[model samples]
Target: MGEWDLRRLRVLRAVDECGTVTGAAERLRLSPSAVSQQVSALARQLGAPMLEPYGRRVRLTPAARLVLRHAELVFGQLERAEAELAGYLHGEAGEVRVGAFATAIAGLLVPAIARLRESAPRLAVRVVEAEAAGAYGLLAAGEVDLALSLAVQPGGGDPRFVQSVLLSDPLDVALPPGHPLAGAPGLRLADLAAEPWIYGAAGPWREITLAACADAGFVPERAHTAADWTAILAMVGAGLGVALVPRLASARRGGGAVVRALPADLPTRRVVAAVRTGTQGTPPLRRVLDALAEVAATVQPD
Candidate 1:
């Protein structure tokens, strides 16, 4: 229709890939209003609404879906062009996509990304936030070039993929500030048995936390479940219930919560990089792992 319409298509593509206008705004670093306006502009250009309602989510109209496919092709071409340019300037080209857990984002990935930006300036990276199992699934599905995941202690391990230990951290119990245990020097496993617990979302996490409690001599009574580390910590801060969290998650939380070691007798969770056994072995992938190594080195205890 017009030049503005073309820009709108890019907005549409961003929204579709990001899953929400809010998500698109974050990626583009644009205001939510800007994102919404672009999508609406595209509808005007098409002379009809291209996004229809489907329950609470928006469903792409047929025309919009067709446009989306073309957007993907355009994106692929853009990637190739960038790669070609990089290859012309250097010996390698391409981008790496990575996924990691919330705790790792704070404890590990931020510094890694910063180092990668400074040292491997030529490499392009896309970071996705997800849990351990999801990170592995992304690795298997080729949705990510690298996955930073947690190795649940003593569980057999993933047979189909390759793993390299990135680092390990102990898990601890978080109690709300001013709680009776907040002022205690240390707490034992049995001490936590009767406390209402905050279990990490149902997955290997549930098993790991439960197993730690079991090692302490009693199974913790579950009071709630949450996937979001912030929410879990916030709840703990509020004194809704106590939670067992990795040390990293406990770092940023200050809402009257006290963290205590879960005894020296238990196993710690090891975070690692899982790369699918075989892939292109691209430069972008290697750069990411190298950056991660740099990040790990800084945090490892001497």
Candidate 2:
């Protein structure tokens, strides 16, 4: 046996489908003799009988039937590959894995996904909820194409990645309903200093909470620790403690918690997108970045 010829296999499958050399040739726009010759070459290459004569036409031998079955799969896969390639070339489709914090996934990525589906229906986006540092780790490890992180990740001069500021997410205070500071017209971080705090899971957000409190001249008294904004808000609602929630995370403040803005000069986390240095120019990635920017634009930064 020699190397398999895809052309010969195609011809063999065509013959099996059409049930005759003449019919296969008509479908393939080749002479019946050429079709018969292709099938003979295929049989010779495989060292097996391809077709057996029937009453008037010809039928595929068991060996040929097996080859045709596999050939059909090959052809189908090639067709799919071609379609996907076309999508990549047009910037309308491809898989983009995004690693982002939970807050950004809800406020930014979720909205961007809706737009992407409408604008590039064939594009596929896989999102992973990760903290700032973890998201950057995944980006560096090649597990994710884009990472949405806070300034705490600090990719400033890293040669391995290109970090672009996506937005500035302001921190807000989540107080229990009817708490002393809830009635105040203008809230300052200092006002909540004496109250017990429900801090977020250890990461950039928790760091932000601590730093904000330190700037306000007191350390927060922690009564609860949670990774989820909802859980933190619920604890605050129960009067367990107050919490520092990002604007994006507390947009729909409820569960008996009242959200208040910090002073204009107070701290806000710089949300950013990080991609491999050379990947920013990729068509699909470019589209995803553009969509993220569009979504971020809608947020009113403090």
Candidate 3:
């Protein structure tokens, strides 16, 4: 086979995904004829048929499937090469932008950036305050190099990004200082079944709270819905209702709220750092990721 054109391979992959040259053209923002030309050229170069007519659509031939299986690996390797070359060209002097929630900014990114300043003086780190649910969008759009999020579960995540768990932040119950269970030991989620709850109006935290409550055999009567930790803790402190506060946010418990750990088996918010797939190996990104992991290791609930 002659030297394969990466562009043609990409076109073929798009056709395989879309199942039609017109669909692939729309996806690739090219004319259908151009899409067909690319795939045809690729097939000619490889001396095999790449696609076959299937009713009104098209399907990949056995040869095309075999080629795609290798093409995917080649594409991934090229991405890695580009990332590594960028790192090499920039040395250790490039900037790394990170998007994270407020608490993670205070608890993780801040400390990580501080460490990087000492260890990699030329590498600048920028932070954007983004919630977990929306952070991935920023990452996908290339607005951020790293995104600290809670939405990516262990063993399951978007294939387009590489996710690494920074820490599992346990959720503790926060109550008013004078609440009956303020100093209680051996507390469990079931024990709070009757108490009014304060949780996020929507988002992963809200889902987690509801799911944990349901697993405890009852639904919480939500007396207040607040997304900010400060507001939630404030409500708890005022005896309005109890709230499930993650350890990462416990540092700002403020006055009148008492935080207590629940049973060891309770759910924990998994804080993960995600980078664009194949970019994690770059020196600047690797350094920053290491710094984040180091900071996360020492993070303790206050």
Candidate with maximal lDDT: 2
Selected candidate, larger lDDT, 1 vs 3? 3
TM-score of each: 0.65, 0.73, 0.68
The sequence of per-residue lDDT tens digits that candidate 1 reaches over residues 1-302 is 76545467777877777777788889888999998888887887767776777666666788889877887787789888987877634524457788888777777878877876676666677889887767887777878878887776221265656678887767777888888777676566677678888876577688878777777778778888887777778888898898877765656766667777755554467788877666425556766777787787777632
lDDT per residue (tens digit) for residues 38-131 in model 3: 9888888999999999999999999999999999999999998887666545545688899999999999999888887877777889999987
Candidate 1 error regions (>4 Å): 1-92, 153-159, 280-282
Better of 1 and 3 by TM-score: 3
| Tens digits of per-residue lDDT for model 2, 5-102 | 88998888888778899999999999999998998878888889999999888999999999888888989999999998999877788999999987
Better of 1 and 2 by lDDT: 2
Cα lDDT over the full model 3: 0.86
lDDT of 2: 0.87
Rank the models by lDDT, top first: 2, 3, 1
TM-score winner: 2
Q: What is each predicted model's overall lDDT from 0 to 1?
A: 0.74, 0.87, 0.86
Of the candidates numbered 2 and 3, which has the greater TM-score value?
2
